[model samples]
Target chain A: MTLTLEKSPLTEAAYYILLSLYEPMHGYGIMQNVKVMSSGRVNLGPGTLYGAISSLLEKGWIISAGESDSRKKEYQITEFGKKAVDCEIHRLEELLANGKKITGAKQ
Target chain B: MKHSTWRWISDYEKEEKWLNEMAAKGMSLYGFFMGKYTFEETEPGKYIYQIELLENFPTSPESVAYLRFLEDTGVICVASVFRWVYLRKEAASGPFELYTDIDSKIKRLSTMKNLWFTFVWLEFIIAAANLAMVIYGWLVVGQMAWFNLGCVVFLVILGLILLNFGLKPARKIKSLKREQLICE
Candidate 1:
């Protein structure tokens, strides 16, 4: 599938969310995982996370895995989300390689 | 202590800011109806309030599910009136925000604009109907012309007020769109 970063660039929060959902996780669990994965650089506020979750769900990139408890619902990234994440990774790698070449980081 | 306060605020920012300030002053909002707000005295600066403009409340399944999701995320919904929801979280809970990104904020503001736009059109229709009735009273009925004209004037004023309310959200939505474009 043709992938364009302009058409599907993942927000920092969305990227981390997809990463966290490699395994099914509840809302709070996903939040904790994102924080750990980002090394405390990204803190997902409840509102921000909720918005990302809703958008991802609407795009069919994520599916509800069911309730984890009496209160929280669980979610997992779909095959669609996995492909999107792969595209984002490639885009980021290209950006990094181009930046390193221009800046003479290895020279 | 429970105290009832009456306020007529059409702007969401102003209303939310006012509620937060009151909370900072030890007044936690309990509920709201018509123009009245019931506040309960509590520890000063204990809670932060966020106001959400819902298109449908308490009836729509989506609205109910949205609220449930928010609750699962630890936000407390204190009250809802018509299409407005008053939410609160502890002051120590980081921040009480409903729309963290510009796009989500724009969406929230757009909902408010839509609601107000509906009011503006409905009021316009009512004002036009009242004007027609007033004209009929003056030309055909030849009775209570002054009373009918008074009603027409009242309807026109109400329509103007609703239009003003709609304009506030429209401006907010415009600024949000501009910010999003610049960020991109």
Candidate 2:
């Protein structure tokens, strides 16, 4: 799957959300995971996360992993989603590497 | 004991802030219908209140799913007025917010404007019709033209008021888009 982070980077909310949904998880689960994964630095509001979920679903990066009898629906990342995350990671790493190289930290 | 208060705030953010202020003052909003807000006494700052304008009726399956998702996140759906949903969370819940990112915030504002765009325009339409009635009565019919003139006056003012409310969010969205551009 071709992935691009060329035009606009994913919002910080969407990035953390996609990362949190490696397993099939519901909204609350994703929220907690993002908070923990970000070292308690990022907290998502329901409205923001809800919008991100809808946008990601529309883009086909994620799919609703069949709702259980439980009322809370779960979502899982598709292969496309994994590729997107990988692409974002590559972009972030490039920035990091370039910063370190210019700062002469790479001796 | 429950007490009810009336409000006519057009801006959602201002309405939300007023609800939070009431919560902070120890009267928590439990329900809202029309322009009336019902509150029950609670400990000061006991709850955090949020309000959102859903893209569809609150009873729709999509909105229901969204509310369920919020409920799972410890946000309770307290009341709904048409497309507007009132949410509450115990203050103990860490940092309750409904929109975290700028894009989502812009989307929220857009949805807010959409929900009211029809009504605002309807106001203008009614005012325009009344304006025509006023002119027709004064020149052609010449009876009770003053009544049509009164209707035109009232509706024109109300239309302008609602139109201003509609424009506020549009302005907000434009500035937010600029901010996103700079951040990008």
Highest DockQ: give the candidate number. 2
Candidate 1: how large is its RMSD? 3.5
Ten residues in a row with the worst lDDT in model 2 chain B? Answer: B111-120
Q: How displaced is residue A53 in candidate 2, in Å?
A: 1.1
In model 1, where do residues sit more than 4 Å from their true spots? A1-6, A39-45, A103-107, B136-144
DockQ-based class of model 2: medium
Compare the candidates by TM-score and give the number of the best one.
2
TM-score list, all predictions: 0.85, 0.87
**Which stretches of model 2 miss by more than 4 angstroms?**
A1-8, A67-71, A103-107, B5-11, B142-144
Residue B30 error, candidate 1, Å: 2.2
Report chain A TM-scores, every model. Answer: 0.88, 0.86
lDDT of 1 by residue, B67-133 (tens): 7777877777889888778888888857665665676677777777788788878877877887888
Q: CAPRI verdict on model 1?
A: acceptable
